[model samples]
Target: MVIGIAVIVLVLLGLTFCVIPVVAHRFGEAAERAAETEAIAQGARGGVLAEHRVRFKESAAEMAIPFGIAAVLFALAACDAAGVGAARVLTWIVAAVLLVIGGFVTSGQLRAAQWTAAAFRRSSDPVVRGLDTEAIVSAAAREFPAWLRPLQVVRFLLTTVGLLVVIVALITPSAAAHFR
Candidate 1:
């Protein structure tokens, strides 16, 4: 039972942290490109300054939520693996709360992305929106918070600990069974 729990936790952490970020990043980039392409084709040539803020907000939120959730899950998994039983429950509650906050922020950022796209579509300027769509895309994608990398480092340590616990649990089922 503990083995099962450990496997589930590890798999979820992998998906949440590893897979989701890549997928969400690609999704956000695609959205930005599509929005820009459609706007350009529709003759809505504007400047970068006009849409930069919205794109930054949307991109930052897009990136932050997955990373934040991954960090929280790593912490929770480590706690669970340590047999911090009640603390695990509290950690889960904390994760849920953090996720809810991320959701609200991400949702608002998505709206901002939509608004940026709409602005591009409705833009009356002939400025061409700074000409290089790639630059705009890259700028937004790179707009992550400075503090995110430190959190990622902490997540990495927690992940290492969690994996070690799983390895130990697998090698001696009885020893880990109590954790279940």
Candidate 2:
């Protein structure tokens, strides 16, 4: 029973660490880029300031859906009837790699945004110059921030945890159904 329960947990963790992050990254990118573009169209300064308001909100919203669903699944798995195994160690390794990449991505985002903004500012056209420095030009482009380091670490941790979850799922020596 313990093994089965663990397996279920492992699967849920897999979705959380793997699937959820991908979806969040994708949609969040869209939301941010779009919001920035909209901000520029309306006229704003302090590019950072312009993007902070609406784009931030949109990015969070875009990311929340998948993680929220994964959370629910985790809860469900926790109440399952059996124990799980420890074979999921492999998946964690993969998750760690993904997270490392994610870290680079986060840092890259900030650099890219800075360069893009600088380029826009240097353009010879006055209209482009007048377009609001703080506002984003598109939905897909924005600064990622240095905080990605922690996120990368967290991702690595989660991958390790996910492996443990799979182990639990496979070992299932006991059952906690009806209530844990």
Candidate 3:
């Protein structure tokens, strides 16, 4: 039961943090490029563009819920696994921390996109003033840093390693006995 719960939670986290973003970015790349080009042509400042690419200003509530749930679940799993040994506890702790960090990173990226899109929509530039704000916002939301890809790779690898360790520990009879 513990193993089942852990696997399910990890799978959900993987989908939420890893798979969906890559798929979204791939499908939305062209549109984002077009929007950036248009925004540049309309006299959007380079500094603003750079800020839009990196800065994220938004409420924390968006990140708190999902990450909080994951944290709680992992904590429960760790407590249940405690009698097994220190290794499971350590692995769960590491995985929970990494997952929380990943969630924050994702939340920031999303907020940056929203901020950029809103900034563009409010601009007085001729092209921006005339074009559909919805389209502009959609494109801006799709924009992400080049570094995100590599970061995602590292995050996925480490999280997977931690998850596997937990799963293995859970499967062993001696380890599983404690949870029961």
TM-score of each: 0.43, 0.30, 0.43
RMSD in Å for candidate 2, one decimal? 10.0
Q: Backbone clashes per model, in order?
A: 1, 39, 0
* Local distance difference test scores for all models: 0.50, 0.46, 0.51
Q: What stretches of model 3 exceed 4 Å from their correct place?
A: 37-42, 45-87, 114-135, 140-180
From the highest lDDT down, the ranking of the candidates is 3, 1, 2
Better of 1 and 2 by TM-score: 1
Q: Per-residue alpha-carbon lDDT of model 1 for 78-150, expressed as tens digits?
A: 6666766564445545544544554454344434444554544454555543234444444454444444344
Q: Report how far residue 94 has shifted in candidate 1, in Å.
A: 1.9
Per lDDT, the best of the predicted structures is 3
Candidate 2, lDDT over the whole model: 0.46
Candidate 2 lDDT score at position 95: 38
